[model samples]
Target: MSSPSTLSPWRLSVAPMMDWTDRHCRYLHRLLTRHTLLYTEMVTTGALMHGSELRHLRFNAEEHPVALQLGGSEADELARAARMGERWGYDEINLNCGCPSERVQRGAFGACLMAEPQTVADGVKAMRDAVSIPVTVKHRIGIDKTESYEFVRDFVGTVADAGCEVFIVHARNAWLQGLSPKENREVPPLRYELAYRLKQDFPQLTVAVNGGITTNAQIAEHLRHVDGAMLGREAYHHPWLMTTWDETFFGDAPAQRSRDWVEDEMVRYMERAHAEDGCPWYAIARHMLGLRHGLRGARKWRQVWSDHRLKPLPPREVWAMAQAHVCNESDVLVA
Candidate 1:
């Protein structure tokens, strides 16, 4: 086992999804894929710089090889945030210029920055200069109706010149005016070919394609051309797909843990959460509901745990109900 920073360049990774890839979610994903790197939801540079350090930068050790994604345009602020991320053990620090949200636009960042590649290049260069760990960037192919393939090719070329080695290209155009954030992730037509061409043109830069990619087969196929693949909604909605990534991508032995066994692993997580003030088990458990998809009584498990009855229950009691679906009669009683 190589240290996280050393092993990261070799593996596939998941994207940092807003309201989706929190600490609990990252922990759940870790069980399914040991080697594939994970990312935190994009934390604004303002929040990271001005907000409580313990609140915004905290993460469990198990989520190693994880990268912290930051959204901001200021080179100094982004550099400061990158340093904080490194101090807190984040394996990588990424800049987000791809999100098409109005709020992001109001701040003078996100997809709109595609037109300001020079500014993004400065931000990337500043972060890279601030940290020895990998500093990367994720962006869209184009904004609004500007769908020229050369737009993204140029974006990659400019950013790479600033010393960014990894590029996560979401192969779609962001309609910065009409589409909402949720719509931006979906309504945009995914143009994977453009991303493939980017890899061809910028062979020295590691290019990874994101958006509309939902299956291992799709990831495998994309890998043939590009350096990596990143999953967002697909990875969230069907988490079990990640269970094979460790064996498939990293060549680790296939983990035979049943869904029940994975749930048991959550107990250690729960105990840690309980000890940490201001943290609750439900906050973490919500992300784990999709863990048992396609299993017998999986819906029941979701319903029961989500019930208000379990809200006030201690970690032990919550673990009891979560394990009920898999534990046999004697095992349940013993627990």
Candidate 2:
């Protein structure tokens, strides 16, 4: 655990998506962007305290600057979980207050907690007291039908008073009732201005905008107003977008690996997983389906890699088939 200043700047990050930002997925994302901070899928205090700790907390050393996003409302429980995250070597501990899922609501956490700003503040304080690492919060602009800017502004004020320094604001409302999580993401129109306003009003606090940002241009635009920009599904779906993130956003040296090289590395990784960890290649390959996105013959290449029949074969065989499909398409186009 260290001071916020010692932590890497949250210039760009991948949102903590459930069932998506697994350790394997984070490892692949790290291959593309060396500087962007990655987050673990939201892990609840109950799961970490009662469930298998290693399964829920383990990650690769390569996934540096990764934050562990925890979902829970109890101050003591959250503090305990935050301590565990620090023990596990996570760079930051983020409390999730923006999730709209019914499952999260049942846990008395997530977007529902936004209504209890003081409780969230208390939890933030407890975690800060428990861990030396930076403690942050991610929440929506509003909950349910509340559209007033004052609501979120006050929430930030209360939490900041409790020692949380960085706030990741999802620029949308979370409808706890009626709307599913998917609808919550789409139905709530993005009001990035609210996030920008937060930064303006609270110049001392770090504010990062999330929601409806898809392209690098949009990230650049948001960075002008806020401290960081967080990408959700878009980063997972089109991972190549991150290939240039290190250079484009963080001003790091350009990534040297080409798409082919990345794929080859993944193949070797899959082979190692199969041999040492007994992991199935398809399980690893699913995350890479979008690797060839927007390229010539990309769909056909993906189909080849996704074919279940190839599961019995080695990763190299699958890679060969995918490459052969792309080459055949190129030959046809040349003619």
Candidate 3:
């Protein structure tokens, strides 16, 4: 069949979360796995046009191979926003067509764009023409009850013609009318085979599957069918899951780092962020509360870092408090 999929950067990645995949969150994830691509939160074209550019686009130099995910339907605006992403040093530009949130729909983008493939093609072509970096699309298999495979097939064919070589398929139908965004993620059944079929049909394109994949074994399975597998909340809540990705998926020698070391490194980043941006340490610390997931005393440790009272204290000091919970079993009396 097609050549093996592991050679591409899109082979493994974290989905672009809204408020959850901000720069600080990306920094923490980068520390866990180096090769896996990271995505910025979905920033609207309007925000880029009228809002603070630095606040929307600035990212750490360390977050390389990272993509800027844009939300909008207008061709000119998407092109301009994409140029800004390229100027800011982003490695790729991804157009979001899978989001089902009402707010995004009201803005005339997201999964609603799936209903208008030509508009998406226009945006993709504009962005592709505007920047040298790769332009990709993240979308659902279908919208509402349009379960016929032909619907998604045409969508891919049209966009692929416009120059998008990489597609991250969420593998579920987005019911735009009856469900909340949270419900959309849960109520829809995942049809990963549709994603596999897209890859089979367009062997020249890079196709990755995302949605309800919670474990590395699951990711490995999807990889067998498509070019890649992307984890969303699973990666965010249990980031340690990514620590093994370098060796397990990318064929690197075993990583020489540990969770404790990653936590220490994050503390240093916090100091620099606070000193430079005047950001509160707690703002950064909140992202790593899941760092200790499933481990002994994880709950208590999470409680320590997430405690608002600790905002007055430095990150290192808050770190010490969290460590105490992991170290001193007696602290279990209260989180």
Candidate 4:
């Protein structure tokens, strides 16, 4: 409900996952925490330039404080994409240099660009020149087995010189050759101290640590060293973790939406989506399966919502059935 510009840029954020963090997913995230900056899935420059702008760029206004993560190496193309992102009203534009997918490497971008800091700086400069909104960079600490802190320090220094004030550092090396994208995330050892050192060296730049951050306690620990912490898989799998972020991390009041209240709001969203856009309930429901994560009857509640047989039923009906698993006997009887 508040203006995004008023919020701190690097206090907390969700990572720009490739398949995850779509607009619908972001909308669900927004309902949980109003202040955490959310990022769109990495959109390649080719896709933004050649594909449907509306399909790739359109987002709900409620997903404010959202950043568009662009994947590309070309300075001019990235600049053009940044302009489109600004025009679409995104609060920030982040360039992706941490993704280790072979597909991304083939495009001459992603983690591969870490070896070419000058090229990334050129791209960052172009985008910064093109858009007035904050232009940030998300990158890995090193590539392959290079353990020198200097590699990442220089990369940050180069990009910062190009006007990138914020750097979301994934504290791991991106092994481009042997590992799959999923493996890249797990196999690489996280060296959070490298990220901390970056903050120490570049005291003026806003440095946020990513990779292996799962809990609010860990986030608190990272904040003592860096400007922020960015969560990825953990946020998607156990999304309720975000509900407490505003109060715990940002010092806001307790969240106004109880778990039950959030469920009800999502039901209303599903109803509106079905009515206005003919959007399938399943598309939206998948994002909420983790809402009850770690709670009693959570698995059954997820099962009820995920059941394809319930597709013919209204969203309210599906919601009622799911609530039956988690609600008290009296509440079920009332329903």
Give the candidate number with the greatest lDDT: 3
Clash pairs, candidate 4, are none
Candidate 1 local lDDT, residue 40: 93
Poorest stretch of ten by lDDT in candidate 2: 326-335
Candidate 3: give its CA RMSD in angstroms. 3.1
Which parts of model 1 have CA positions greater than 4 angstroms off? 1-10, 322-335
lDDT of 1 at 190: 91
Off by over 4 Å in 2: 1-8, 327-335
Across 192-267, the per-residue lDDT of candidate 1 in tens digits comes to 9998998888888888989998888998899888988998888887788898887676666788876767777886
The window of 10 residues in a row where model 1 has the poorest summed lDDT is 326-335
Candidates ranked by lDDT: 3, 2, 4, 1
Say which prediction, candidate 1 or candidate 4, comes out ahead on lDDT: 4
Evaluated at residue 179, the lDDT of candidate 3 is: 98
Best by TM-score: 3
| Position 25, candidate 3: lDDT | 96
Candidate lDDT values, in order = 0.84, 0.91, 0.92, 0.90
Summarize candidate 2's per-residue lDDT along 1-335 as a digit string, tens digits: 23333544788999999999988899899999988899999999999989987889999899998999999999999999999999999999999999999999999999999999999999999999999999999999999999999999999999999999999999999999999899999998899999999999999999999999899999999988998999999999999999878877776678778778888988988888788768898888889888877767887999988898888998898899889856422233322
Residue range 1-51, candidate 4, lDDT tens digits: 334445467789999987778888998999999889999999999999899
Model 2 alpha-carbon miss at residue 190, Å: 0.6
* Model 1 global lDDT (CA atoms, 0 to 1): 0.84
Instruction: Score candidate 2 by TM-score against the native.
Output: 0.94
Model 2 whole-model lDDT (C-alpha atoms):
0.91
The global Cα lDDT (0 to 1) of model 3 is: 0.92
